[model samples]
Target: MSYKVIVNATLAKFSASHFLKEPFQCSRLHGHNYYISVEVEASLDENYIVVDFIELKEKIKIIAQSLDHRVLIPELSSDLAISETSESIEVVTNTNKRYVFPKIDVILLPLPATTSELLAKFVHDKIKEIYPNKRITIKLEETKNTIAVYKSN
Candidate 1:
């Protein structure tokens, strides 16, 4: 039989800013208090548990902390031109809109857009690194009514 372990502690959350390339309203930069929940499914190990709850929570916390209070940049976007200098990063959109942020306040991700679905996948991959071979699911709540879920096959 398969067992599942889920971690959705209060600390597994972050506040960050990001923009999408579609839907005019979302194109404008905005911030959100993002909540993350992770679930790992696996057969029981020697300990008769799928995973340790404390360790899972800690891993999720660390992932959230890395994104806390930062501007997330999708470095792989074709519609965005991103340039980095000694102390700052500049982003120019295909529409000629530009944004400048301090280098220290940015986290460049290998993604095409900073959408909730993609972010959920990103978190799933990070946690998968720590618990390889297990089926993992990640849920990212961008707002009270909007949430995205990603699952590994």
Candidate 2:
């Protein structure tokens, strides 16, 4: 039999901005203070633990810090064009909406959309990179009432 361990720490928090193209109201730029929760599934080790909680928390913290206080752009979005300079990053949407942000304040992710569900998957993939053999679930809470979950087996 296998066991699972969950790590839900306040440290796993990030404040970031994104926009959704389909929903007109959501297409406007907005930000959220996102909370992340991670669950790891594995058999108990000799220490009688699925994994080291401290180590897992640290790994998630690293991922969260990278996204904190930044604007998340979908690098793979067909309707968006992104360009960068030493001082700033420029984004132009298919509708001719343009935004310029400081280079230090933007994170271009290789995703089609920066929705909560995709964000959960992104975090899950990042964790999987560090724990390739582990089955994992990642939950991203965009707000008090909205959350998205991604699971890998």
Candidate 3:
């Protein structure tokens, strides 16, 4: 049988901004206090545990820290063109909207969108990179009522 270890510590908090390309209010840049939860599925090891909760939490915390307090930009968005300089990053959208952010304040991700769903997948992938033999489920809460989940099995 397999067991799951869950971690949802308050330390998994990040403040980041993103904008959707859809023609809506969300298209404008906005920030969120995102919360992340991770579930690890594994068979009991010789230690009689699915996985070490402390190790999992620390790994996830590292991922959160990389994105905390920054603007998330989707590097693969065809509708957006990104140019980087030593001091800043320039983003020009297909609609001709332009935004400039300091290089120190941005996190350019290899994703197509910056929505919660995609963020969950990104977290899942990052975890898998560290624990390729384990199954992982990631839940990313964008707001008090909105959450997106991604699973790897």
Best by lDDT: 1
Q: Which 10-residue span in candidate 3 carries the lowest summed lDDT?
A: 2-11
Off by over 4 Å in 3: none
Candidate 1 C-alpha lDDT tens digits along 3-117 = 8888873559999999999556989999999999898999999989899888888889899999999999999999999999999999999889999999999999999999999
| lDDT scores in order | 0.93, 0.91, 0.91
Ranking by lDDT: 1, 3, 2
RMSD of 2: 1.1
Instruction: Candidate 2: list runs displaced more than 4 Å.
Output: none
Residue lDDT tens for model 3, 73-153? 999999899999999999999889999999999999999889899999999999999889889999999987899999995
TM-score of 3: 0.96
Look at candidate 1 and tell me the lDDT of residue 33.
97
Model 3 alpha-carbon miss at residue 101, Å:
0.7
Model 2 alpha-carbon miss at residue 17, Å:
1.0
Candidate no. 1 TM-score: 0.97
- Residue pairs clashing, model 2: none
